[model samples]
Target: MSCYDTNIYKVARLKAGKTQEGAAEALGISVESLKAYESYSRLPPAGVVDRMCVIYDALYLAYQHNRIASGDVKVIPEIEVLDLPRASIRLINRVIQFAEKRRDRELLTIAEDGVISPEERPLYEEIVAELDGLIQAAMELKVAEAKEL
Candidate 1:
């Protein structure tokens, strides 16, 4: 994504009601450095990112950072700040949906032979996608809880 499209650092700082000078001071970096990070001209180090999460009270920044760093790899799932009750309900619904699909049985069957044949590839991918969804829901709930803290 282009810097214009993904100026999350600036957005998070702004959402936290911080000015550029204040955020820069709190982050222990120069205003230009903070601006670089916000503009995506330079990526902040992991440590700075962590401090930003706390300083800005934006835990989602961690997820955003990982997503940005991983790029197309998508090691991190896209998540949103949800209310506690909504997050809980969403997580429960995902669990129920996964269980209803009975993907566990299919996964066991696929793994029983210790190989994924061409015919099984599509099913395997579907199951993995469902599993990733479950993970994402759980992470969303966790983030919601953390935000409540």
Candidate 2:
């Protein structure tokens, strides 16, 4: 038997106020199978893992909504701020516009070049910093959305 921590499953079950048998019925699995998972006697299959994630996400959202309604925590939808460099944003915009017009991968080459003019170096650096922020924000957004679902 593969030893895997079924922490996620246990947490989800607890959060939903479900016993092992109850969760197994909800998930269309045998109670013994659910017990095996909770005890780490066996690892769930890939399909079970995917289903568990979906169920957990839905349960998490419902829990959050309930908590908010009960005034347990202030309901604040998370917002991520991206402070990308103006120059980079402008360059990206220009590239997008060019691509829209010409519809070629060649234009992307110009965008990928690191040969910034001396005067544009500072702007480029700022854009790079902003790009980092943007990427972080996007990742955060994805996490938030996943939790919401």
TM-score of 2: 0.40
Worst 10 residues of 1 by lDDT: 1-10
Per-model TM-score versus the true fold: 0.91, 0.40
Task: In angstroms, give how far residue 148 of model 1 lies from its true place.
Answer: 0.9
Q: Candidate 1 — which pairs collide?
A: none
Could you tally the backbone clashes for each prediction?
Answer: 0, 1
Error of 1 at 34 (Å): 0.7
lDDT of 1: 0.88
What local lDDT does model 2 show for residue 102? 53
The worst-scoring run of ten residues by lDDT in candidate 2 lies at 74-83
- Superposed by TM-score, candidate 2 places the C-alpha of residue 3 at a distance from the truth, in angstroms, of 18
Give lDDT tens digits, candidate 2, residues 7-96.
Answer: 546766777677887778777899999888766577677567556656554333333223333444433332232233433454466556
